[model samples]
Target chain A: METNTKILACEYQYLESSELGQVLTWLEEYGEKAAVLAGGTDLLVKMKMGNLQPDCVIYIKKIAELDYIKDDADALRIGATTSLATIERNEVVKTYYSALYEAVRSMAAVSIRNMGTIGGNLGNASPAADTAPPLLVYDATLKLVSQQGERLVPLNEFFVGPSQSVLKPNEIIAEIIIPKLGPDSGSSFLKLGRVSADIAKINVAVYMLRSGSKCESCRIAFGSVAPTPIRVPQAEAMLNGKEINEELLGAAAQAGAAEIKPITDNRSTKAYRQKVSKVILQEALQAAWQRAGGAL
Target chain B: MERKWVKIKVNGKERQLYLKPNDLLLNVLRDELGLMGAKYGCGIGECGACTVLVNGRPMLSCLILAVTMDGQEITTVEGLGDYDQLHPLQQSFLDHGAIQCGFCTPGMLVTAKGLLDENPNPSEEEIRDYLRGNLCRCTGYTAIVKAVKEASKAV
Candidate 1:
């Protein structure tokens, strides 16, 4: 009775739940056997490729509760199922958080973004995820909820490796909280892919906070250059509280390049990534600096 | 295998379907509804050949589960036009010779219609950006772009 050639060869019982409490109970009961379906852009692909064979397909997108973006005093809290298109076009996100906007803008394509959710992007935990670099630069956090309750985790510690995250089988990402940028601060995200809307070969995002010509603080992160999208604390340290100039930024970029471990993959070579990592970091730094009203 | 009954509005008509858990919306649209407009190209979300409008937005039908689309409104290429009268975008595509293999036509038309519905008059760059998910390997993008531009005026 095997009707082969079915896109999803794995057989699973579809459990439809439109309530968050019910979804959490199912996740707790089914454990790893249950695969939560968010946007299906990533989950369905893995299932079709036979990479995952979950016995239960939990369709939680109908839970209307997990889809809102709220602005608070010092941070913006976004529900997990909020579509990338929504975030990309969000007025508050675009006006202030340009890096996050540009990051979403440079993702897969319009159709994908129309269905793709921020939760799925981080949940799948692709090292080259376009949303990662910018979210890293923004110092975002996640609220993972289970039947037992919820726990908060920083975005920095979320990823373990390729296609991995700290998410437990019974837990679901309920919310993403991104801290608001301070005064005189600006951020930029830059990605280079095979084409305009392709998986990133290498992507960099830089955030700068400056007081006149003095660099108060900065964060530089890159994707597709390591096992996990990472921040270059060494580079940020070099520019921290220092009057940024071209020479200093160039030195910091070089230092940042020395800190990463990029691999040779189909998207690019280790050598190419190693060389351009420094260049993009420098350019990102200069752009961030300029946006922060710094002279350089 | 057990099948679930679901209701969907296809091209303005209400349709009730019995679908399996693994049944994709693309397969259901093509096989059951006889809406051959959405093609199965990549089987994945990469190629735009299976694009369809779900709830007023262009989405990858290949990735969408037919079971999950209960009560959703879908628009395929069949919804666009007929032999006698064509949708402005369909006519424009023909006028500009935008069809090469004809595999990507349905996706292109549906996605373009979705774009125009949202923004009545989109810039050339906007059209190109919106159509990034719909791939035409025939190198007929210039003509496709021209067609979309011309249709924007008529739409």
Candidate 2:
């Protein structure tokens, strides 16, 4: 028998890891009736706002395997419970994926990063999730697990709508997989938030491979300006084998801006976000190109 | 719910508490154990005023569940050096005039302590990046960055 309680304006449930197997059974026993709690950064906020009142919160922090950073050949496996601070400091990510490092570095201040996890950010599926655009450019994949088994989903296909993900009730985001980069490849992440501490009004990520003075292959992604973190294929196609010139950048920026569909929110206006996104995208792409062995 | 007796080395003393099912680490430190050094600025983890050191890493107490810290060590603002002997970072904040209303000081100091502990030598940009979560309404962060650098030099 599960007992229910309330405290500090949020509904609460406490469960032990030993019982997780039972809880998973219970979740399957009562499908879509319970919610799993990881960092509780967003869930608790929603609870405080009276938006989410979960009948049961299966706390996953007690599961020891959920918190780690492991580097396998050709890819990095970041556990769902791994905090953003850990990612910001991990030498592997800093060396291999500078864009991700910068995104984690610029995310909500130190304390919030210390407690917030990358899996939680992705699970929340906000259009403004700072890491999503960068991860999209990297072609990152997500591994979600439930009692039945495990499944892998492309990061781009993970989100179906705002605040909605494909994760099932019993399933949990287990790990994030970032593929290895090839030669002449470099990445960059940039955001235009109200402050250094606030969420991104418009965030851009660029991944480029430079051959001589021209871009070999490139990917540009942006968040908070579309229904989801989207890839600007037109912008990317315009840059292929093209010299990094003001004319080419102007064309790509225009294409990138035209690809997004932004909405006005409390943090920024639709027009301002659409405008700033182009500038940020151009700058971030230029920076990334430079890092990929290209002269300014 | 299963209740467990959790032990933590808080400040200079060891504490054993039977935390309730819904008790947060911030509530346990403030309400149950009377460690007011860690404030409850925001219950939802936006504000950095509730930061404390969990195993030498800066963590938001509001987001940590008390029972989750079974054998972990915690350091609050009060844990850093006492009134008789102050930590260099504490002294630097005072000398640099980093305190405004004193509401954000303890949290700022604790956050800075974690940064300096990890990297005794941080650049100006690194210092700014490390303390990004801590918000101060008064000094705008020019002096806070200076204080962290000064404290690093002193230590």
Candidate 3:
């Protein structure tokens, strides 16, 4: 490959965990002037496109402590640097976060997943991010750390807009905390794309708690149909405590379809996406409901 | 900008080089080490033309930085076998009519080698999944799959 050397100097600073404190200190000193590199999947592309040019890149992949996937008492704490391929193949991830595993499998081909990190995907904050909807349904929280300290924020509130996140310039997403599913909880993710392995034109994730044949609590989230991954409270309210039925599913789907403001993009038409999104949401909810031990 | 010295073991031989700030593994292997078996079809990670074994794992050389590969065992298509004694996969590729223009053959062979190294006996589905990253414009993948299957028995 020909070197694109026309672009001026872009330096890489490799930092092990022992050097993390110094790196954080440097970021604190420089503030927005530096960029943290977890996985080069996204940052490298942006830098090549001339979209980003940080004075320095703080390479954090060498920090073994940051690549952990630990089981917290009430949740699964996934390190920000965890590769998407690892998440897809992990036994615990497949068992607890089935929707996330399924969603990740549907993302770009295996090569990209091997290099892309969950934190990089979230930090990239694309509207069509495959992992966002599943994470949103699980009520995942992000552990953002800086020189000052660490703070936890719900995943739904993480993305402010397309290509924008609530993360601070100097802070890094250290971990993702996914709350443990209750005994009767089940979840499912559904995505519609042009190809079998393409970014979703529309994606939906449903998390439901069942009591016999009834839904005790529910969360419904949608992606690529809005500016950010959207949690449909009105739709969830329609399904909460309700039994699975054609009418209820239709009502919930309609509610979710009514909340989104999709636009005509190169991927799919606005009208077509809006119409197909409702169908996908219904299918996703039914699957989640069935997994929760609810009767169809 | 400062340079980083990375010591890599290529095909069982250790070599050291001082890489520039943004030098990628693909550059070091092709330019510095003079191993041209790994072709550069796409600078981006989309194509598997630059696939090489980094510590025995098939990875896109275009995406890996030379500096991050310090003290790593690297294997290219050339490392597998030479023209005098072709690897089983190379022989199979020739026998099964797997190569057309031959631009994508080296990558396919290396990727197949990686898969077979871990799994000597793989199902048709498993073989397809492992080669999902490799794109072949010719032969429609039937010959490629057959070639991998044949190499499994030999290697």
Candidate 4:
């Protein structure tokens, strides 16, 4: 066929259970045999490509407990099924977590954002997921639910490899909790996609707490650089408790370029990603510094 | 193999039909309902050819299961306007010479309608950004962009 006109193979049985209790029961019953469908943007594409063919499809977007974003006692709680579009336009997210806001805004087109959910992006476990870099820097924690019980897992420990996570077959990500940052803190996200709204070849996110001219704390993360979206601790350590300056940012960028393990892929090559890693890191850190209210 | 009676409101009218669980919304609209406006350009969500407004927001119909849309409102290109009275965006598209091969017109019109409905008046950058997923290989998108901008004024 010139084009793959066939959309879905129509092989699996659709199981719609939007209630949290009902979905949990279905997950308990189907276990590995069931695939949860939230946004269906990624799952349907994989199914159409013959990469996945689960016996049962569990619809969770309508789950009452998993489609909101609001303030908890000490953290910002985001429901897994909340659409990216909703998060993008949220004033709290834009004002407080600029990196996450920018990440969601740069994710895809308007239609895809309207359909795709934050949970779907995390669950898909792609190294190129735009949400991961920002969330990692935000130190977000994911709440995974199953028939057994709910467990809180840090987003840092969530991804094990490409298209992989610590999630079991019966467990679903219910909510994401991001702890509030200090008022003096600021963050930024930068992405280099082939097009304005395409999968990123390289993405960077930086978060810092500004204490006068010195940076008291920092978090730096990169996507599409390694087996999974990873944090650059060594590079971040360079900026911690140091005076915010252009020279230190340059040094941190050099260290970051050496630390990240980029690979030659369809989107970019190891050499090219390495060559530009320093530049991307420098620009991203400078933006983050400026956002942190640093003059230099 | 599971069959269900799916109920959806399309073009201000309600439809109830027996369908397979895996039937895509695009297929249901085109094959079952005979709404040929939403094209099947790309089965994947990357291409916006199967774009349709579900519950007032643009969504790729091919990525959605028909049964999942039960009780939801779907507005296809057919819902916008008829031949008797073309939608403002449709007329602007025609006036701006936006229709080249016409494969991408239906999706462009509906997506542009969504932008205008939300923003009322979007800049050229906003118009282009909102329609990023909808592809037009024929006209290089300048005419389409102009058409959307012109429609913004008339609407």
Considering every candidate listed, which one attains the maximal DockQ? 4
Which residue pairs in model 3 clash with each other? none
TM-score of chain B of each: 0.97, 0.94, 0.96, 0.98
What would the TM-score be for candidate 2 when compared with the true structure? 0.92
Which segments of candidate 3 are over 4 A away from where they belong? Answer: A1-18
Q: Candidate 4: which pairs clash?
A: none
Q: Candidate 1, which segments miss by more than 4 Å at Cα?
A: A1-6
lDDT of 1 by residue, A1-296 (tens): 33333367778989988899999999999999999998999899888887888999999889999999999998999999999999987999988888888899999989999999999999989999888888898899999999999999999999999988999999999999999888899888888899998999999999999888889988999999998999999989999999889999999999999988999999999999999999988888888888887886
Taking chain A of candidate 3, what TM-score results?
A: 0.93
Error of 2 at A82 (Å): 1.4
Evaluation by DockQ, superior candidate among 3 and 4: 4
Query: How accurate locally is residue A290 in candidate 2, as Cα lDDT from 0 to 100?
Result: 78
User: Please, what are the lDDT tens digits per residue for candidate 2 over residues A1-296?
Assistant: 22221234443556556344665676675557676667777766666556776666676766668788998888888988888988988999999798999999888887777778899999988998999998999999999887897899999899877888898877788899998887788999998888888888989999998888899989898988887788999999999888887678778988999999999999999999888888888889778987898876
Weakest lDDT window of 10 consecutive positions for candidate 4 chain B: B39-48
Off by over 4 Å in 4: A1-5
Error of 1 at A230 (Å): 0.8
- Estimate the overall C-alpha local distance difference test score of candidate 4: 0.90
Tens digits of per-residue lDDT for model 3 on A1-296?
Answer: 33562232356554323365776787787678777776676777666556777777777777666787888789999988898977887888888777898899888766677778898899888988989999999999999988999999999999999988989887888899999998898899999988666778999999999988788899988999888988999999998888778779888999999888888899999999989988999989888888877776
Candidate lDDT scores, in order, read 0.91, 0.83, 0.83, 0.90
DockQ (Cα-based) per candidate? 0.69, 0.49, 0.42, 0.79
